[model samples]
Target: MPGQPSAYHPGPRPTTPRRHDVIILGSGIAGSTLGAILAKQGVSVLLLDGGVHPRFAVGESTTHYTLKLFRLLARRYGVPELEPLTSYVGYRDQIAPTSGTKRHFGFIRHEEGQEPDPAEFLQFSPPSKGLQTSHLFRQDSDAYLLHTAIRHGCDVRQGIPVENVELEEDYVAVIDKNGDRYEGRYLVDASGFRSPVADHLALRKPPKDLKHHSRSMFTHMVGVRPTDECLRVGPEDAPPIPWVEGTMHHLFERGWFWSIPFNNTPDSRNPLISVGLTLDERLYPKPDDNNPEAEFREFAARFPAVERLFKEARTVRPWVSAGRIQYASSQTVGHRWCLMSHAGGFIDPLYSRGLANTAELINSLVWRILDALAEDDFDEERFRYVEELQQGLIRYNDELVNCSFISFTDHALWNAVYRIWCAAEVPINLRFDRFTERFLESGDDRVLREMEKTAYPGLPVPGSHGYKALFDEMVRLCEAVDRGERAAADAGKDLMTTVQNSPVVLEHLGIRDPNRRFVYPKPEDLRRMAHWLRHEGPRELSYLTTGVGVHGRPLPSALDEELAVPH
Candidate 1:
């Protein structure tokens, strides 16, 4: 039954040339999700892919922000199906059974030929209970979204590689390998790194100026054991949660390895683990044989803990070796055509930002696209903001990941830099949850549009001056360390001091405490955060507690008494 078409698949590719309102390249999650929304709104969409579904793919992690965006999209577009993807319980009951639960982000730092120190690990969970993340089974998730698009009347073509794209003044023409021609009033290239639209237009920036430099080798495997099985630490030193309960990142100097299990839950039927190793290309150059599985094994052998974890594992799919995973396009939007997120640019998967970035782009893009379609206006100027936001995302992510790779050389620096990541991620994710809450309560699209009119283009919170100032200073210190002007230890101390003094960081969360390895906020912690924001915190972040509790819901009336008491 592998590669078989589902009931929602549109059967039989049409031989005749056809015209559509929008022609999308790549039927992966982003493209297919967009296609489904547009088609549901009565627009004709043509979705094309070079391969069929139930295939191996990566980008298998999700975050709270990603799920929040999905809920917003589902609500705003009247597509209730997307709601199921927003939570673990809903996903297991309504979606596929093969995906895994991600209750936290687990990171364990290691040194070559040494047992990983218990103190070197850190685990950060959702702000509150019941906020469940996921390790997506991309093969099934993609196929499901593609099916949704087809059910919404999107004409789809699979296993048909696009040969060429001709972008004219008013419409775009696509040529297939079999000499079939298709036309559309607008074109969108989500085809990823080897984008046909980007290639035809020569939109790639020559000698890519990306600051991050890394290569990756990835594949699916069986018998990949959990990190808990290999740890030498006792129960008292054990991580707060089981290591198998979330996405595990085994990091070393200048590189890292990811293990995402699909069989984490008791009821899960799948037995595969999505494994990948990303290395700084400058440190570990390409091998002669170019066999990725062999390369991965060699890299894992350097660390005793990593070696034990993978000793019994065997790959079930062909390995993909990528040289320099960073890429950027000179232009993201042009006359009668535009490139999707991955097509526009991509950085390393260090922080799992790929899917989150894609979700952000779609939330801002789809509405403008719908408006343009109604007016029959395909001017390049109409999508100017999309272009700006897309470019800014690439620039910001490049710097973030570039700095992270530099920090990997020293654990103290890596630990300090990670707090900076939390500073940006936590507040922004809280705001996103707030946005979803308001939209769901009032059914007002303006609540969502507020996300688009930001003073900061690519940064998480648009108007929060407190966090932005701290972030800028942190980057300066990190850059100094990278340039050999500052000692890693000194820079790490400075970074922690900055976090400790910043008004934006909630002290109750213990983010400023270097000794605290895990951050799982309890109800009392949330109450303290709310009280501080309401009474003691700076005005810049006071808005975070306006109508919602720390959990992005209305505060229980009884909690007022608890908020008044000191913890």
Candidate 2:
């Protein structure tokens, strides 16, 4: 049944034009999930895809934000089927068996013929089990979602290419390769990179504005060795979450390797592991031969540790390579039509933000569309906020990913840069969790809007100045490293000095004393910090954590031992 669009009963092609409340291009998770949500609301939906189910696709990682959004959408929209996707254990029984539990995000810097320095390795674990995420097998996950859409009364057609889109005043018309016409109040393009809607409307923007520029080569393979076993790190020295238990990132100068296991347990159906190499295009250009497999081998050999991990693995599918993967759209919304997240814009996948971004975009758009339909207003103005949100998110992503590439030049710099990433990510994750909980409890769209105001587009609420300052400094230091203007040792020392001097960075890293720098906190410390932040007043917590007052001056801190107690 793999690749089969389940519950689909194909009959004779439609002889007349078909109309629905909404028409979605591309049957991937984004389109199908939106379709299912709308269909459940008694809105007629049609989803068309150029390919069939169980298709090969990447972007198979999930995060805390993605899970929280899934839960929120399912609960708010009355779609219980999506609730299971929020947890690893629930997904195992309710979704598919092809996913792997992602307990931690691990990274190690490797050099040619030299073993990675254990001291330089980093592994980040979520403080709580509920926050842990999973690595998806997109083929299975997407098909399951598509089937769910069908079950929810969405009209889905596969292997059908959309040839033309005509936007009228009130509705959009879609013509397929078969000359069949479909019309709907709104047209949604989730068709991804080569978006026809984007191309036709001249929405595609040159990626020159983006800070990050990179190319990728990737494939799914079998017989890949577990990182723990390959590295031979002793159990005593191993991280709380084993490196093999989650996504492993092997870093080197100018590039990085991602190893995401699909088979972590004996029950996994697919033994294939997803592996990919992403290189900063400015530093490493594409190989002349253009054989991804051959190029991949050559690249892997540069890191002996990475090469050993993949030495015996055989590809389950053809290796795929792409030129600079960054893209952006000049506009995402027009009369009677709009583009989904991927279609609107996309940056690098280094942080696995794609799924989370898609979820956030869908959540915002679906509500707006529903409201617009109720009011009988489809003006382009109704969904303009979504465009702004999408564009801002992509810009934020560009900044973060672009800065991260500088880490590869040296392990010390990588460590410094990574702390900045963690500082930014921690608050964002917590704020998103809080927003989801608050919105679900109140069922208030205003809560969503208020939270949106505090966000830096693709980030969390309260937009603290401390976090912003840290991020800004990180970017400055990274650019300096990238330009070879700062020595790795000096950069590392500067990073420590920066962290020690910033109360916001200290709180983010769960350190109370600046004297003890770059220390990972124990589980208790993490839990205590999270509880304190959660209990504090929103505005007060923002200032306390970010070190910026409402007037932009450093806020006086009342933080002490008493506030650290868990409620």
Output the number of the lDDT-best candidate: 1
Pairs in clash, predicted candidate 2 = none
Off by over 4 Å in 1: 1-17, 128-130, 548-567
- TM-scores, all candidates, are 0.92, 0.88
How many pairs in model 1 have backbone atoms within 3 A of each other, for residues 3 or more apart or on separate chains, i.e. clashes?
A: 0
What is each predicted model's overall lDDT from 0 to 1? 0.81, 0.75
Task: Write model 1 residue lDDT over 1-567, tens digit each, in one string.
Answer: 221111122224345538887899999988998899888877789998898997777889888778877877897887887877787777777877888988788889889899998887888875533447888888988888888999999999999999999999888889999999999888889889989998998888854588778999999999999989988889987776798998999998889999999899986778999999998898889987898888899889999999999999999988899888888999999877889989999988888888888878887778777767777777889888889889888887887787777888777888877877776666786666566666666565666777677666776555677777876876788789878999988888888888888888876877888888887666688777777877998887776666553335674332243344431
Q: What is candidate 2's TM-score against the reference?
A: 0.88
How well does model 2 score by local distance difference test? 0.75
Worst 10 residues of 2 by lDDT: 1-10
Give per-residue CA lDDT, model 2, range 138-232, as digits (tens): 88789888998999999988999989888889778889999998987788999998787998899888778788888999999999999888785
